[model samples]
Target: MNTVYIGLGANLNAPEAQLRNALDALSKSQELTLAQVSSFYASKPMGPQDQPDYVNAVAKLTTQLSAIDVLDLLQQIELQHGRVRKAERWGPRTLDLDILLYNDAQIATQRLTVPHYGLCEREFVVFPLLEIAPKLTLPGGQALADIAASLPHNGLTAISQYDEAASLA
Candidate 1:
């Protein structure tokens, strides 16, 4: 089984509820087993400050599926929760699920990238990732905690703690 990390975020229509629902949906997937979840964080919109603030969290899972399969599954969950891909990059949305890492695999494809290219740069992704997998080492051998500490993350704040056992079950 491959241990994967996923980032979840939403800023529109009961953001917190959307995140929780996403977690529940992921937990129901037979191909993936939700193992751990980070505390929810409230963050300012990164690309467009004009949009509403976002609620973000990260989940650690063990999956028997390939990278492409995981990506497809995530998209399915997003659609189920009313996610629409607009022309705007990093625009507001009902739900966003990103595969952050996959068992230290280094992948660069048109559809996805493992150890997500933007992982080190975004506090919203890194902080919660650290919470769930602090000892995780990226493909380049950088620890998640060290990477998070090196970045500028003054805007990320934890608003709610998620219980892994309760949320996954």
Candidate 2:
């Protein structure tokens, strides 16, 4: 089995609920097992301040599927949650699911990038990821704690705990 970390974010259609529903779906998948979840966080939008702030979290999972297959599954879940293909980048959406790390593999293809391009700079991704895996080392050999220490909070705040009421199980 391969261990993967997924970054989840949403700023539309009840962002928290959307994340919960997405987590539920991931937990139900036979191909993957949802192992750990970070606390839900609210953060400023990355691109375009006009949009609502986003809710973000990171989840850990163990899966038998390959990275590409995992990407496909995440996209499917996004579509099921009403994600639309948009020409604009960082626009608000009902859900955004990204593969942050796939078993310490550095993947770069037309469709995906592992360790996610924004993982180091994005406080929303960094802090929550640190919450679940504090001592994690990135594929590039960078310590997750070191990355977390360098990023400012950027108004990111933990809004709620996962596996409590947020999982929607």
Candidate 3:
């Protein structure tokens, strides 16, 4: 199994609950083993400010599925949650799952990119990612903490956490 990091974000339709549901769906998958989930960090919208703020978090897992397969699953989940793909970049959505890293590999396919294209610059991604894996490093060899520390981290606030007890019920 390959270790993978996934970034999750939502801004529509009960964003927090949507994130929790998505996380549950991932955990229940037979091909993937959910490992660590960081607390949700509420952050300002990355694109048009006309929309709502996003609740973001990071999830680490071990998966037998390949990178493309994982992307396919994530897309399916997004669609299930009423996400509609448009021409707009970083638009509001019910759920956004990004493949941040896939076992230290740099995968660039027609449909997906591991080490997600914006991992280093997005504070929403870095902060939650740090909470789950403090010592983690990107494919570029820079320490995760250093990258996170370098950013101003403005407009990001802790909202909630992944609750083991509630998830178990």
Worst 10 residues of 2 by lDDT: 160-169
All candidates: TM-score: 0.94, 0.97, 0.96
Residue ranges of candidate 2 with Cα displaced over 4 Å: 164-169
For each predicted model, how many residue pairs clash, with residues at least 3 apart or on different chains? Answer: 0, 0, 0
The sequence of per-residue lDDT tens digits that candidate 1 reaches over residues 1-169 is 9999999999999999899989998888888998998999999897878999999999998999999999999999999999999998999999999999898789999999887888899999998988877788888987777888788776899999765467666
Q: Total backbone clashes of model 3? A: 0
Error in Å for residue 110 of model 1? 0.8
Off by over 4 Å in 1: 164-169
lDDT by residue (tens digit), candidate 2, 1-169: 8999999999999999999899999998999999999999999998899999999999999999999999999999999999997999999999999999999899999999987998999999999999999999999999999988888998999998767344543
- Against the unseen true structure, what C-alpha lDDT does each candidate score? 0.90, 0.94, 0.90
**Residues 60-163 of candidate 3: C-alpha lDDT, one tens digit per residue:** 98988899999989898888888899888988899999999999999887888778999999999999999999999888798999998899788899988888
